[model samples]
Target chain A: MKKVMLLIILIMMAIVFTACGGENESSSASENEVSIWVHTSDETPEGEAMQSTIDRFNEENEGTYSAKIEFIPRSGAGGGYEDKINAALTTDTLPDVITLDGPNTAAYAEAGMIAPIGDYITNKDDLLPSIIQQGTYDDQLYAVGYSESGVGIFYNKQMLEDAGIDLSTLPTVDQPWDWNQFMELSETLVNTYDTAAIDMAFDDKSEWLMYAFSPFLWSQGGNLVSEDGSTAEGHFNDENSVKAFSFIQEMVKEGYTTITPVEKGFHTGEYPMKFGGSWTIAEMEDYPDVEYGVMPYPTSPDTNELVSPSGSWQYAMASSSEKQEAAGALIDFMTSTESLTEVTLANSVLPAAHSVVEEVQDKVSPQMNVLIQQNQKSAHARPVLPNYPQVSRVFQQAVSDAAYYEENSDVQELLDDKTGQMEKALK
Target chain B: MNTNKRETLAAYSFLAPALILLGTFLVIPALMAIYYAFTDYYLLTPDQRQFVGLQNFIEIFKDPIFIQSLKNIVLFVAFVIPIQVGAALGLALLINKPRKGNIFFKVAYFSPVVLSLVVISVLWLYLLNPSEGLINSLLANIGIEAQPFLSSPKQAMLTIVFVSAWQGAGYQMLIFLAGLQNIPSTVYEAGKIDGVNKWQNFFYITLPLLKPTSVLIMITTLISAFKLIIQPMVMTQGGPMNSTMTPVYYIYQSGFSDRMIGYSSAMTVIFGIIIGIVTLLQSRLTKEDDI
Candidate 1:
């Protein structure tokens, strides 16, 4: 009994000592330390480039400030990194700087979790308009996206050829095909293959629904919310939005796309075309047998305006940080033209700045260059709202419910029903 | 101190670690959940929380998605309890007597219980895929058309029920096996002396003796069935028109993904009450059976 009690006491003492040791170590580094939390594993090329950028920043700012980076990888359903950030918001243990998704700028800024770093950026004019638009909330730049992302129609060259489609007549960023023409091509492919013509990642059933499919709504002259980001009722359920929803529903109804696509159908050559983003470039490297090419988004038949989704992870200064200047410096350094080019080239992502685009234009693959071109010409960022997640979820469910193609499945009614849900979130 | 007091102190000291862990991880969080249910606590703006009495609870009851989730969970629990418990008892009976290569059958039946639920869900997702899955190919060979297992809202909840039961019945089977072993052989011997056949012996003796174990399994399985989240989260993501959305999954989505902590807490509290009532009802009925 005595020995057991002594053992317990020793264990307790050891735990106390370890806890104190950890606090002492952190405090020692707290004087000039600028901690950063990123949303990727360290082993990835993007994470390595981020670390090198931080190391360079630390070297230049040596005795004045030191920056430390922590990588918190997100899971498939967008949990780990965001979960840590949410927990830290309550506990007040957030790092000096943290990485957040682009659409979250409004939420974070409105909640006072992130500070505006617009004045910190040295070359703000050099950043792409879409990146600036994505990072800005209420006319203040709360976050700066390091890399831009854009979705495009990825088509299998062989399948298109087999379906008797002309290669030279395909859409380009400058002169994109209209939705009617795109559907005609989808019809041909479906008739030839006797299967779903495209994989729009409908099976993902998450943010991808809004991210990849919202372009259609935008091209049709519909907005998820008003320009003021105040309401989603008339805009989300308006005629233009209904046209976009029905267009999506038509594809599923006509057997041009499916709600449940085969996993990696495009990569495996099971589907002729895929609605894919810039990240799909890296993913396509594994599929050596399939030769693919990128095409700009199909414009709406009525408006003929091209639009594509744009948003990626961005860096922001945490509101809890006392050393705001140092945090701002780190954010500035990481999003500098050179750092952006390095990160973009390493991750195979679209460039966030014009200078980085010029630097990586010749180096990146032609497929990626096509996406970059579309991004510059036609990218539209998602709606920036404090309750963007709920709004996006409602939009996602609307897409899913509409695409199921049952009797009495009124697209307008579905949109109106979903609009009510979005309105609740917006409120 | 007296010897008795010292012993009691030592016993408490031994339990200190587990008690502290439970208090920190479970008890405090539960208490916090109850308190947060009455407030408007958004996840991002935690410090800006406000106490709005019964607002969250009232709002959740009105929310169509929450009501749909409640309906789905109840349907799941209603189907899963009997299917899972029946399969467990069937397996327990199959392995009760020693047979050739019995260990292999036991291991095979118990293997899925040890595997992670996420892995099982993913594997089943591929197997249940409408077109390219192995199950479809096998069905094709048998001249049965491919079924849209997870894609059809009408079929998704039932499909999940089967997958969950297949994955969960092994552990319950082990418990039933123990209960079977605890049944005295002398009782069976006396039944044999009374000229009772095997069927009569099982129906009259084995079943009557297994009531306590069956009741225990039913209560546990009932509680777990109410907490179905992982399978839907991994498989369908509460989709195909929210056909498989369980209450727990909706609560997680509300709190973590949608960042509506107050609403989610209200949901958790309501779900807890429902479970408590159902469990009480089950136990009351079982007690009457004993009487």
Candidate 2:
């Protein structure tokens, strides 16, 4: 009995010792340490390059400020990171500096989770104007874009040439093809070559399909949610979007975009033109035999304006950070052109800062610059609302189901059910 | 008298740790589950609960999805337990006959019991993947069209059951092996001398002696089958319109994903009661043969 009591006491002592020991060790470095939350490209060569730079910074500025990097793995489209940030906020253990962007930066900044970065943006000329627009949310720079991505048309040049489609006379960046012309080219390529569907993945979570397709929904006179962003608009059932949805479906039905069984689909090269982002360039680099070209997403047949969904992951400061100064320093260092260029090179996207783009222009592939330009011209982001996740989830499930069961499924019914559920979830 | 009193106190003190452990770990949690079954608790946002009355129960009943899962659970238990236990018993009986490499056969039959559930699930997932799997390739050779093993609603639940039975049959085989060892050789020798053939001798001799072992195997197998969560989770994720969704999976989904701790507690309580009732019925049905 005495032994058991003594053992319990020893265990308690050990826990206390460990916790206190942690405090004691950190106290020495806390003055010099910058605890920054790093998201994206932490595993690639370019990510390695950024880490090496930080290592150099820490070694050189050892007495001034030590770099304490905290990496969160959120590689694919940066969808699940918001829930984690929310969880961190509730626990009061947020990092000194965290990364977020697009709807994410907007949502959290509104919630007062991220600190303002206006004081940190003295080097404004060092950043891109469009990227600067994304970083500055609600009149204050809450986050700096780590990398920029724009959804656009990525066509297999070999597939087009084999289909006997003349490519030298193909529409250039300045002379962009309209939706009707794009459709004609796509249908001809598929039919003439007898190839598979358009290269695209149907993800209901990120709804990045919105990037490739939803811009047209807007251009053809539709909105995802109501103007105030208080309600979902049931756009698939709306007259304009219904026609747009049918146009996309006709691509499938008319043999231009066959229903490629999930396996024999785009990523496998069974398809020709992929409506995707800059990352598509990185993915296609492995297929050296397959030559591809990049352009803006097709303009709407009616609107005559090229549209793409613009979003980027950014770095932010957590409200609960104890080492605020160090964290801010890390964020500042990471957002600098040197680090931004490394991130862009790794991710196959545009540099987050203008200076970085100018510095690393030769380093990045030519295919990727088209995406950067596309993002600069036109890309809209999802509405940054607290209830946006729930709204998106409900909308995506309905739309995907609508696409699958085009006839039997009622888009209005699904919209009504999910909207009600969204309202309940918000409450 | 004082010394006697001190000894008595010491005896009670010795029992204190065990009593505290059982009460804290088992009894208290059970009671808390029952309490929370009547409330609506979002685990992520604690300090907020509403007295829901019988609302959770009503929701469970009204939810077609929940009802279907319950029915599926029962069907799985009914079908899997018999086949698995019977196969184990037959295998045990075969190995009981003294032959060359009898121990090797016994060990070979029981090898799968040593494998972890996750390892087994992964192995089966690759083997069961319809497009590029061993099972489908073999089926194609027989001039059969590739069957949607995990993807189709028609085949998913059954595929999970089949995989589970294959993995779990070995554990029950050990129990049956022990039971076979307990049977007397004298009765079998007498049966051989009497003109009773192998089938009659086995049914008449082996069946009665193995009653207790059968009962034990059945009860344990049913409990395990009823708590089916891993196979469906790793393989199907309870999809194709949620045909493979189990009660325990529902409980996890409610507790962690939905953060509806109160609803999950209600489910846990109900599942506990169901298990208790099943155990009671099993004992009652089998207790008569014991005497």
Candidate 3:
């Protein structure tokens, strides 16, 4: 009986050991296979464009390399695709090329999960400056964005006209209205409508807070971090940042916006305006009653400098993969002018490269044209920091806290406290 | 070759598969987590990890968000256990007597339990929306103002508590129902012979007899409450101001979102210790009652 028990234990141990040891030993044993992972399902237009791009790459490279694509769509809470990537990181089973969000460029590069691909990119200058900015970390380009994104103030044309405001007198992307002008317009709309003036999506207590609202800080000559992305103390807590924060607080205090806005409030014309991105254009099609037009971001009163947020999923090479040249060629092909045009048009997203910008200019809608112009002129990528996730969370909290700002809610103090938290994340 | 040896061999053979699975999946990962708790094991840079001793532990204590998460979870468990267990008891008692449509009532009560938590949470999110939700519209019909149930930090945890109880109590009610059924009718007949009234019979007989079932339900509810994540994740993303953040949710965020696996592991260890102490106290008290 004792011998039998010992034998059973040994067999179990052998099974466990063999199971653990069964991981593939050679990543590049099949040298021609170039695996690519994207963060959208194949059913989506963006995924279809990605598949076509890979098909083109494979056809062009033919026998030397065979590019394959896998779509892993992200969940609503932003997990599925990233969860797979994180798991793959530990198992050494990461694909040759992977799609990452733009802000993660610094973190992935710093952790050595992705390799620098500056030497691999063929048309570096043709890419939009914001795309380059979003993909660079510590002076090295680690990734290349395949598309760009833009946020603008989307308004109900009927509501503004009913409020006796002339549409043409409104600020254009070339010369946008300042914060004061925006607020005045909001107050008029609110009084006329007897409801909240705009939906800032304060209810979306996620990365949207940081992504959509950070440009407000930038427009005020304030930044979440310093130029080199080293620190957040003076920059995040500066007077300019406080001014931008107070502007948001005032909007909340005056009932121009609500922390808990009705779902699709702007879509249903419950609000006169919304601080929405280019994606809202497609969603607006569902509501034909609300005639809407895109407007540039309301600039800070001090600088009157226009700055809008820009970022999207970008392609990066996985460090674990030995097929660096093949992966690089695929990435270059995916971000090429023709590929970019196809993707931007198919997905109805902004063009990442200047050449594609011209290719897509006349093809997209007039509202999209406004966003494209904004992207070309004033789009700013978020700070490229290795601790961007933590920092962004703190920034999001600051915006949330300020939105509930009362008389006791000193904007400076709130920013100062948040800056401390940002400092901790930076360390 | 005796009977004793043969029986022992049979028992060992039956237990082998389960033991191997437990060791491979649960025990190994738990051991790995404890080991990583002492290191700076960033998820993306696993190979570059370095031993950092109690640094991660110390940092977690210093983190205000971590402290707030701990407080939120404790509060959630404190409220959810009693409310959920009590609701289950009430429901069990209501359905204990056999009557018309008993099966229909049972299924209706158990329906939420069978549905996915994510679906329930999303449904509740829309229903509790401040302005456009059905709940607020109902409130408005009575001339009451719309409430920011999930968006307000002051009310978010309590709102989650009620929601959790609504979704979870049904399963516990089924357990209580079985426990109720196990109580023989003769005991109630004896109570009736002693001239006890309806409320009196319930208090003197049903209450004391249901002790074991109630204890089991309370313990399970307590533990599940401490593991709160999905509701907050789906509904609020752990904030209008991190009011609904729980320790488990924060641990997940640190490990996956921030890639600070070591810090998350440290939090897990600490959370496990806290749970261990609570369960130990509970068992000790329950044992005393048994004695």
Candidate 4:
């Protein structure tokens, strides 16, 4: 019996060893073949559009060059997909063409994980300024986006009308609502509607905080980091930055905005207004009964300056890729005016290319035109620094603290704490 | 001599596969973590890591977030172990008989254990929502004001502890049930003959017999409590104001989100040492109880 058991165990060990030793043979791509890794799966319209683009690229090149895509799921722990990309970088297994969040471009470029595509991209000047700003690192173009994203105030039209607020009198991009008027409107709407005035999506304690609210800081003439990008002390803790955050703290304190709101507060009519992204346009279509309109971010009460958050996912070439030329070709084809129009239409996003925006101007809804105009005029890319991930996190936490403050809670102190954290991280 | 050698070889063959797996997955990575903890290894620039000696460890003590995380986890362990172990014991005692509905009770008690922690956390997040969640809605129905169970900084950690204890008690209950069954019915009958009442029998006989089982449950629950990450990460994101930031979640944030692999590794090393010391102390106490 002992001999039989020992023999069985030995056979099991052999099988295990064999299984462990089996190497995954890399699919032998021809010299002309280039592989891409995209975050979106083929289930969505955007993913399908991307796939169709790749298929068209392959068909056009025929035997000259081919592009294939491997879909990577972006959902998981906060940085799960980025972690996968980082692992691939370490193992020298990164795909030739890679799509990454625009804000990550600086970090990837600094780490030498992505190569600059300025020499390959001819239509750099045609791309929207915000897109160009987001994709550039050290004054070099490292990535290019096909579509841009912007956030604006989405107000319930019926609720606003019921509150006796005239739609025509509302702020426009050229003459946006000053911070004081915006707060007064929010207060009036809350009393009239008997619901939360605005949904700033405090529950989404991630990149959303920095993306949607940083415009307030910028419009107030404050910046996340200095021009040198070496320090955040004077810049993040500046008078304007403190004032900008104070507005948010006051809103939360007075119950104008909720620190913990239902996920779809505007769609469900739980709130009169929402500081929502362009993606909300698609979501609003689901609720046709609830009429809504988009307005530019409210201007700073002190400066009357208008700024809107901008930047979205962009494609780049991996530094380790041997087929850089072919990868660059894939990126160029994807971000072309024609491709941008198709993708922007399919995804219901603002087109990155200036020509695409102009060509599709009359075709899209009036609400979309608002986003397009903002993307062109008022959009400001998030701080394009290598330490952006850290900067965004510290700022997000500080904002959360201020928003969830109780009595005696200090907004300036929170901001100063974040400033210190950012300084330490930059070291 | 040849026969003995052959027997030893056969035993060694039987152990090879498990040993190899352990060495590859757990032992090697643990050693690597120790080595990396002494470096400045950023996840993005893995090859550019340089030795920083005790700098990372020294910094960890000074990091307010890390200190807060340490305090939070210690509090979590302190509250969760007793509550969970007690709940498990209560449930085990209630269902350790041959009653008609005992099987049903066992399944009901253990259901939460089978559910994934993420699913449980998400479900509780919805149930605990202050405005429109099921719990608050029910509270409103009862003419009671809604409680901000998760949103309040004061209540968030305690709420998480209660939810974690509720979810985890069932697994430990099964172990306690086994310990209960091992105590012979004859022992109880003997106590009954001596005119000992039910409560007296339980206090004198059942309580002493359960010491080993209690120690085992305490050690396991303590270890698991110290590793609390998923609940806070999914439910709170360690906020209202970093009130629920456990050591493990902080380690995860440092390693993955912040990409500070070396600093995170140092934290993991410290956390591992703490867990090790706790386990050793628990075993030693249990052994002394046996003596």
Between candidates 3 and 4, the one scoring higher on DockQ is 3
DockQ score of the complex predicted as candidate 1: 0.66
RMSD, model 1, all Cα superposed?
3.7
What DockQ do you compute for every candidate structure? 0.66, 0.12, 0.65, 0.53
lDDT of each: 0.92, 0.70, 0.90, 0.88
- Measured by TM-score, the strongest candidate is 1
What alpha-carbon RMSD in Å does predicted model 4 have with respect to the real structure?
5.0
TM-score of 2: 0.74
Q: Could you give candidate 1's per-residue lDDT for residues B99-177 as a string of tens digits?
A: 9988999999999999999999999999998888998999999999999999999999999999999999999999999
Interface RMSD of each: 1.2, 5.2, 1.3, 1.3
Model 1, residue B269: distance off in Å is 0.9
Model 3 Cα displacement at A207 (Å)? 0.6
Better of 2 and 4 by lDDT: 4
How high is the TM-score of chain B in model 1? 0.96
- Summarize candidate 4's per-residue lDDT along B1-291 as a digit string, tens digits: 999999999998999999999999999999999999999998888889999999999999899999999899888888888899889999999998678989999999999999999999999998999888999999899999989898888899999999999999999999999999998889999998999988998899998888888888888888889999999989999987899998999998888877889999999999899899989988887788582
Model 2 lDDT tens row, B1-291: 999999999998999999999999999998988998999865534445789899888777765556777877987888788778878888887888889998888788888788888788879877876656788899999999978787666787888888888888888988998898898889889888998997898788888888888888888888889999988877765654557879998787666545567888988888888989998998898897684
Q: lDDT score of model 4? A: 0.88
Best by DockQ: 1
